[model samples]
Target: MTDRSFLDWPFFEAKHRAWADEVEAWAAAHAARLTDEHDADGSTRALAAAMGEAGLLRAACPADGKLDVRMLCLARDILARHSGLADFAFAMQGLGTGAITLFGCEPARDFLADVRAGRALAAFALSEPEAGSDVAALATTATRDGADWVLNGEKTWISNGGIAGGYVVFARSGEAPGAKGLTAFWVPGGLVRVVERIEVSAPHPLARLAFDDVRIPDSHRIGAAGDGFKVAMATLDVFRATVGAAALGFARRGLDLTVERATSRKLFGAPLFDQQMTQGAIADSAVEVDASALLVYRAAWLKDQGTPRVSREASMAKLHATEAAFRIADRCAQLHGGLGVVRDAAPEVLTREVRALRVYEGASEIQRIVIARAETAR
Candidate 1:
């Protein structure tokens, strides 16, 4: 079980504690089935639907038709600790539907209603073959027609790429080149074609999509013509801290598994936990987990207080937590020796899941750049 002492901190309220407990209980009951890597799309979609049915997804959206970043962070931390797939399911629900919550018009809001109820699976389509962290380099184009817009381009590494019911696509409007020319649109599925679904080490379903003369009504546009950059940034800003929360969850589980194995295994005719080296490793894991929790919750608390932006804090949390999770998982795997490398070990699963967190959202290198730029600007 995770340390409940953090709940006593002033950063969290009674309601937050209650919500965390509920999510933790739900996860304990569901994580086992979702752990199967086979049929990842089926597992993820089922988990998403179950999360929605439990009313937990309601917390993902706010009453003002926006998202509360703090709640998102809390939920991700709780769920990820229990199951990575559960965290993936919940995080995608918010990320895929973020533009709609932040900048969607009346019609867009209506479309998002399906998302809130889990009737629609949504996706964010911003990264292209050439643009990952550098949003300014996106080459997807959207040209205006009589009463519609024609979109053409390819988006790669999109989460829920093949399974999403619809996508919030970002494309250049030709108004101006680079970031200024960008616009966001709500494009329903089947309009765009899935070119390829990339298989990676982790075994989650990700794909590359191609928009060949895809026509969407002007009404599908999310914000102003040149406001795509702002919309994307706003959405990412709200959920950025939650990425750290997810990493923390993975770390906590890795630590727990390590501790359990250490206490049970024997070395030198004594329990492995009795060794000084084992004790030191356990202490290090505990300290890192606490440090990560502090950083992640601090970012969430700041955002919930209505801070305009938290780029510095969010980058710090994502960088530190994700890096820490990788280290914690690696150390745990090492402690497990030959058995750790086996797929069935809990620590091995954590090792695989945590490996990808460092690359997604923004890579560790990109987070460092964000942090350095923010510090210098200050």
Candidate 2:
């Protein structure tokens, strides 16, 4: 069965355990959204609305602005185990408004409640065609015009791009050069147009967007002109571990589904579990699932404890969990034989979803560099 055993670990508080129970029930109740193949945009919007109605979106926008990293991790773990699309909806709500949650003034933070309530959607517009993981290479520019900022550039691979009511955009504001020259702003979607829609193996409203001299008052800026890098990195610090948690969920689900299949599927007048070869595969995946969980929760616990700048821990968690989860999905798919390759199969779906996780937020190579740099600096 689905493991609720992680909730008892010391990484969680009593209230967190109770909250996990709630999310588990909610996820089970909405099993229909487990697959995100058809009409991804509509599915994402519907999932967000459902999660908002259930009050789960509150985790994405805590009233205190001090997000409980443990809660965020647990919620993502549960929801991802049930439906990755649900996790996507919940995660984007937090990530899309993460700068505001971290640095926005009262005026900018005003619309967060609307996002949390599902009345509006938000997108994180940082990656550009030339700058997927290289944040400094982004060509988007926001020029100062009197008291206003005028944006002109393009952003690609943006989640919730077209449907979002607003976006958290990062662009070069020329404070210094390279990374330091960036700034964060809140741009309404009305000012930007979706130029193209990009589809992946697992779909989720992916798009490319363009801004042509879109003007906004200075109030929309998320932080000071020179602070965009800090704002983006800091926001990533809060959500990075949760990405690991999502990967962990996928790994655990992979393990469970494989086990269920192995125990029931017969080969040569015996269950697949009776084969030592099958047992070896399942055993290896089980160990990986636990290892992934430990790394994921440790990073989250550290964040919740206010150990600021968890770049090392978060990177390690995300790197290992995503890689291991994909491996586990691969193993499970192999064990499933021909069924795994069929459209919409559990292993097929997970392999696709986990593959994307390694590329987004930061690539696996980027995360490895982040972790190694942190370690060697000591």
Model 2 C-alpha lDDT per residue in residues 1-378, reported as the tens digit of each score: 777787789998899998888888888887454445677887788888888888888888877787888888888888778888888888999899888988965665657888888778889999998998888898999899999999999999999989998899999999899999999999887888889988888888889999999998998988888899999999999999999999988888899989998999999999999999999999999888888889989999998888978999999999999999899999889989998999898889888888888988998999999998998998
Tens-digit lDDT track for model 1 on 1-378? 567788888898878888888888888888666666877798888887887778778777444675667678888998888878788888888888888888865656755666667666778899999999999899999999999999999999998898888899999996777788899999887787999999877767799999999998999999999889989988888788899999998999989888988988999898999988889998999999999989999998998888999988998999999999999998899889988899856778889989999888889999999999998999
User: TM-score for model 2?
Assistant: 0.98
Question: Cα deviation of 141 in candidate 1 (Å)?
Answer: 0.3
Superposed on all Cα atoms, the candidates' RMSDs to the truth, in angstroms, are 1.3, 1.2
- Candidate 1: which stretches are off by over 4 Å? none
Clashing residue pairs in all predictions, respectively, total 0, 0
C-alpha lDDT score of every prediction, in listed order: 0.86, 0.88
Error of 2 at 290 (Å): 0.8
Worst 10 residues of 1 by lDDT: 61-70
Evaluate residue 311 in candidate 1 and report its C-alpha lDDT on the 0 to 100 scale.
82
For residue 211, give model 2's deviation from the true position in Å. Answer: 0.8
Each prediction's TM-score against the native? Answer: 0.97, 0.98
